[model samples]
Target chain A: MRVLGIDPGLTRCGVGVVDGAVGRTLTLVAAGAVRTPADEELPARLLGVEQGIEQWLDDYRPDAVAVERVFAQHNVRTVMGTAQAGAIAVVCAARRGLPVALHTPSEVKAAITGSGRADKAQVGAMVARILRLDGPPRPADAADAVALAICHLWRGSAQAHLARARQEFARRIETARQAHGL
Target chain B: MRVLGIDPGLTRCGVGVVDGAVGRTLTLVAAGAVRTPADEELPARLLGVEQGIEQWLDDYRPDAVAVERVFAQHNVRTVMGTAQAGAIAVVCAARRGLPVALHTPSEVKAAITGSGRADKAQVGAMVARILRLDGPPRPADAADAVALAICHLWRGSAQAHLARARQEFARRIETARQAHGL
Candidate 1:
């Protein structure tokens, strides 16, 4: 399945697109950033971000979307911006009936670099090597977006398996309960 | 002018519409809440909010929108949700080229009541009186939404005046500079 990954930010929202499924060769589709002027008011800036994301969605038509889950542990101001920006991406994807998954920063790191504590450079290096690029995607935000896409391709498949297994287990339990009339 | 007020939340988003100017008697057009199930995922929850806000905007066609500004000082998790919910409202209004203003909680309270530190009950009572209602609007969220609408009718006017004054001052300074060839 094709996936669009978003690294949400108010000033610069990083975006990347990739095509792949479990045990499949990943194809790099796009990498870019949606930038809004810092001096603009919040409402206008958010609208700009929305338009940029919509353009990408219309251009790529990805089957699923992956967004970096925002955490509140950092600077309060920055955290709020991240959450707001992330909301725009989430709402856009959900509006289209697309499957949207949010992966935490550590999860993205570990999925790509095999270590949750991997620094930016290590993660960037891994993304480059995995994508078969000469170097990491230009601009750190683009690199992060690519990493997030790659992470989702790997982890989303695992999650799908786990969900299916849970459903099967629940069905078996219900069947046994009905058989005993309990 | 008609104004729509939004008190953003994840589970229940308060919404109200009022028609009035700063010195005019306020007319309540609508008061209600847009509720999303708590069990819903974040993306779907946000989409729910976006749809709710869009419905209001389409139904009322308000000249401006007033949304409660979110702060991050208390409860980081809750703050993120509030910010996210508020972003949906902001984006919806901005998409239509509508003027969107954000008022802090204290500002809304102070504009409706005599004190910024007014309790919820006091604010509710004042909102009922100012709007000449028999009682406050139903549900705390609905009451707050109405209060925010009234607050915007008052405070938003003052802000517009200040903005016009600043613009006029800048224009005069620019004219003087052009005359002096500076």
Candidate 2:
């Protein structure tokens, strides 16, 4: 399965795509960020974000999208910007009929580092080690996104397996119905 | 000056335009909403939002945009949707080189009514009375957007006055420098 993970921000959004199978090795396909000028008008910034996401979607074509869920904060402006970025990810994933999985920061950290309170450096190190890369990803945001993708890959396999089981059960039911002429 | 107020949402965004001058009465120029299919992919929905905002911008040509600032909630999905909608509004205003102002729900309520804790219905009623409209604006969201625009108009005028003062001061300095051959 191919998974695309995203860390959304108003100024910069980091995205990573990973391809792999359950109980098997995973590969990093693509990674980058969409950045907008801080001084630019909000509309232009959003357009830059949209265009960047579109390009990534077209290029990667991941089967699923994993996005970090927005967490509540005391700062209204920061919360607002993060929320907007999160929405862009949802729109991008929803438009393509790609199933989206949301992962909280804690969940991703626990999945990757076996600790819910793992710091950025720890999570980045874990991601780099797991992916068998030379070094940790730059711009911590990007590394977090990659870790989110890894978490999804680990969790998503269970979902894929369940779906396959359901399909097989439906097929068996249909075969039995045919035999009974019902 | 003409001010456009926008209430951003995932499925629908309400827009209202008001025209007025400082120390003069404000008039509602136009009001409507842009709706998108919830089931469509996120990108398509975003495109719909962009087109919708573009149409309104072209039709109204407002001097400024006033958008409601999104607040973070416990529901990550809902928060994400609101954020995306907010970004679209920002992008719409920026593309036309129009200044964009953001107002919190409480701020808009306080501007329309005496209390910041006023509910949507009370705020809608106040908006209708303030705008001298025939009736309460349909779709409460649309009325809230109008209120937000009114708030911006009031606040923007104050900001403009300060900006103008600064510009005049700078111009006087330049004139003095030229006269002194400095």
Using DockQ as the measure, the top candidate is 1
Per-model fnat list: 0.96, 0.53
Model 1 residue runs over 4 Å out of place are: A160-182, B159-182
Interface RMSD of each candidate, angstroms, one decimal: 0.6, 4.2
What lDDT is reached at residue A37 by model 2? 88
Error of 2 at B113 (Å): 5.6
lDDT of each: 0.91, 0.83
lDDT of 2 by residue, A1-182 (tens): 89889998878898898898988988888777888888975667776887788888899898988988776653666766666777767667776778887899999999999999999888988889899998777677788888889999997887888999999999999999999999
After TM-score superposition, the amount by which residue B111's alpha carbon in candidate 1 deviates from its true location, in angstroms, is 1.0
lDDT of 1 by residue, B107-140 (tens): 9999988699999999989988987889888778
- Give me the candidate number with maximum lDDT: 1
Across A1-182, the per-residue lDDT of candidate 1 in tens digits comes to 99999999999999999898877778788998999999999999999999999999999999999999998998888889999999999999999999999999999999998899999999989988888898888778888998999999999888888998999999999999999998
Candidate 2, residues B1-182: lDDT per residue as tens digits? 99999998768788899998878998988887888899975666776886788899999999999998776753656665667777877866876778888898888888779789999879888888878987767676688778889989877777888999999999999999999999
Q: How far is candidate 2 from the true structure (C-alpha RMSD, Å)?
A: 4.9
